[model samples]
Target: MTVRAANAEALRRLLAAEPVLTDCVSAVEAIGLEPGVVLHAGPPIGWQVMCAPVQGAIVGALRYEGWASSEADALELVARGGVRLEPCHHRGAVGPMAGIITRSMPVFVLENRAFGNRACATINEGLGRVLRFGANDETVLARLAWLRDEAGPLLGKALRRSGGIELRTLMAQALQMGDEMHQRNVAASSLFVRALLPSLVREGTGAALERLTDFLAGNDQFFLNLAMAAAKAATDSLLGIPGSTVVAAMARNGAEFGIRVAGCGARWFTAPVNTPEGFFFPGFGPTDANPDLGDSAIVETLGLGGMAMAASPGAARFVGAGGVAEALRITEEMREITLGEHPYFRIPAQGDRGAPVGIDVRRVVTTGITPLINTGIAGRKAGVGQVGAGVVRAPFGCFTAALEALAADDG
Candidate 1:
């Protein structure tokens, strides 16, 4: 088949996806994650080559799982191969920075109702000193434990009682309400809390309900994981479309950036990752930033986060993408390389136009325009947590390599 035809079919499948938040469960329950098997963000890599933040997260997970008693012991365990590291994408899941998901961690489950495919992501731990950003102190561990033992189970019960929330509709509404669903998820998070509050109240007592409500209210990024899961489910539906050059996933492991093409099966095209160019936190600067990292780029693959930038002009200043004109220009430039616009995810700033969707590798190679990703920057050292938020471009080399492979297959 022709590249255009193949991409058309892939786009059709993507547009048909109907991702819904079906349930909440442990990583093991949701994705069959086994003991000693830890999933991290981006393409696979060994402990020796992993960046500081990822190594820090693995150490935290090891201690949290009781597989190791200390950071030194955790490093020893990883060095000896006592712990297995895999990419979340390898197991139908996605996660934010550091993106560590252990067996006991709670995951949000999203099912693509139209395609019968599913994907999951661990619950967001809020900002600052969180494990996702590589913080593993007692405070971080304690919060993680609370998520595993109390908040996770309660949220699961609430989801069960309320049936399931349809994510596409929620995301669409959020886009209209100035949320690009990454870097800035304030509107979606608020909407999600509003939807689940009644069910949570029905299932919890005074203090438990109060704690859960407070946590949800305080974490404006609470909906990010759910959006990641939804995007994963939606994009996975387009995989394996023979000859299609559409990008099915984009991820970073701090050390490397990678992309998977729909027609390329499971093969990954990778290159050295690029550090984000944007603002940093107080006392933090470019020198302290880690290279872009996370499975959160899956949202970009499905055309929500950075691709929908025009929808959230307020996020521009926060992520250092400049003013409204820059945001609009970014989205417009994105359209030059995408296959089409998302039918459901409309941008009100663009006169209710759908956000661009289906990142086409051929178009990217031809146009030399890589997809922009909205992201949180992790600190260079272990345990520093999030240093800032910004916009980064997926490595251009990944697209060129993917296009070459696709052309070879066609030849």
Candidate 2:
């Protein structure tokens, strides 16, 4: 291994590309849902990740499906042997909070034409203790119903009318506006709202219009999930890329940490999950934090999240804000280890260069640096759920294994 860096043009050819987005049916197979199928994560979970917001969301979904009389029944069914829990990602979907995605839920679909793989994610619930974060209560449930009955249909109608929102441009815009498009999506959400306004206004038939206005008025985080989904969809391109040592995805549950490599297909290399070290909410400390959950880390691998931490200093409060200079340095440091840079997510601070791209296992092994993850903290005690969110680094062992695997394959 050598310490030399490639020239700019060489780096450009080595990395810098965008994946495509397509419909789930045309893109993904067997694992994805058709129009009629609502996917559920059965057992094991027991809604243990069940925070109040998520419980309310699950109950709302059950209610929406006409399967339960009230939320009480929904909870009862979830607790007993009645209902099934499913990972939204399994069915070509991603959700926020409990991220319980339903079948009819309109999803943003992305395809990797180069590799013949695809990924999907549900829209974000925006900020607050929304159901995606596992918050269950009247406030959370009512909001869920409104999104289902009002926002969901209206947005779908708008998309139908206005063709569809092109995610490529949106992601590019988000990067310049200080979003890595994964952990930090403020700018992307604002842009998405602006893009959807015309359709929302057109579909505003009395109640729909009123709901649309209300949702937009208060919800700044609305587009986060879409941004994450799009990133997830885009990064899937690196999957199955032969001889490439890029890090495609990084995710964790409270129990384990995992990484998927470009050369390894879908097989996950996992390590024991560790507790995150950073700031916490008032009245809560390290004791309240859960390990980690969700597939959102895909955004980081795509050159967002902590990698683009330079763009969003305000993100520090949410994840134990680092010094401004330190944040900026962090993003710069990532290039030493990454395999490529994102084609769409360019950083203004970097003179409009795309954000540091695909993570190279070889680069990481050679440089001895691990990936940094900024994640939401879930409570280990279940029911309580979501203590706070913060930036944390992934264990080096995870990357080491991935590098070794990629190296062995090269031989």
Candidate 3:
């Protein structure tokens, strides 16, 4: 089959994906994550070479799991190979920056009803000093414990009671309401809360309910993890489509950026990650920013994050990506490298045009336009948490290499 035909088929499968929030459970239960084994975001890397934020997250996870009594102990344990590290993507999951998932952590499960595949992601821990951003303080661990012990179970029961939330519809509605489902998810988070509130009210009571509601209300990015899981499930459905050059995943490990092509199976093409260029938090600047990192790029793979930028001019401005004109330019440029537009994820600002989808390595290499990712910037130092938010391009090297691999596979 021609690459074009294969890519079309892959896009069709991806667009047809129906990811739903089926459950929330411990990572061990949801993904069969073994004790002593933890998943971090992006392509696989060992403990020694992992970025400080990822290492910090691991240390935090070890403490949260009670496998280590202190940060020093956690470091020692890792040095001794007492802990195992794997990429969340390898296990059908995704997470944001320093995306660490421990065995006991509660993970949201997304099942692709159309494809019968599932993906999972940990709950968002709000903003600053969170585990995902490498903050390992007692406070961070405490919130994680609350998520696992309280919020996870409650959300799971609510999901079951509501017969699971259909994410595609919700995401579409969110796009229309000014969410690109990556850097800015305020509308999506609100809609998600609304969808679960009725069921959540039916499932919990008193202070617990109040706290959960408060947390949800406070975290405008709470829908991000859910969206990541949904994206993972949808994109995973496009894997291994013979002759397809469509990018199935794009992720960063802080140290490296990687992409997996549908035609090339699970093989990854990687390059040095780029530091995101955008506005930083108070007291932070370019020197304080880490390279782009996160499995959240999966949303872009499914054509909803940066690919849907035209749908959220506010998100563009918030991430220092300029105004509506720049947003429109970015989305239009994205179309040059993608196979088609997402049917449901339309941009109202662009006359309700569908968001570009199906990143094609051939088109990227030919056009010299890499995929733009909307992402959070972790502090260069571990445990410092998020420093800013911005846009970064998936390394052009990754796409060129992927294109070569696709050619070799076809040959």
- Show pairs that collide, candidate 3: none
By lDDT rank, best first, the candidates go 3, 1, 2
Candidate 3 on 1-411: residue-level lDDT in tens? Answer: 888789888988999999999899898899899999988988988777888888888899999999999999998998888988889999888989988988899999989999899999989999888988788999999999999899889999999999999999999999999999999999999999999989999999999999999999999999999999998999898889899999999999998999998998888899999999887889999999998899999999999888888998998998899999999999999999888888899888888889999998988989989999998889989889888889999989998888788778777
Which wins on lDDT, candidate 1 or candidate 2? 1
The residue-level lDDT of candidate 2 at 144 comes to 60
Score each candidate by Cα lDDT.
0.90, 0.62, 0.91
Name the better of 2 and 3 by lDDT.
Answer: 3
lDDT of 2 at 373: 72
lDDT of 1 by residue, 301-363 (tens): 888888989999888878999989999999999999998998999998888888999998878
Best by lDDT: 3
In the range 1-411, model 2's lDDT, one tens digit per residue, is 221232232234324334443332211232444432334321124457433444555776666555677878876776675665655545545555456666545555655443455567665656655555555556656766666566666666676666666677787877677665555667877887788778667766786687677766666566566666666665555566566666767766445567877667676777766677777767788988766566677677777788777766666545775767777788888878875566656777776666776677777777887777777776555345557777777767787887678667767
* Model 1, runs deviating above 4 Å: none
Evaluation by TM-score, superior candidate among 2 and 3: 3
List per-candidate RMSD values in Å: 0.9, 4.9, 0.8
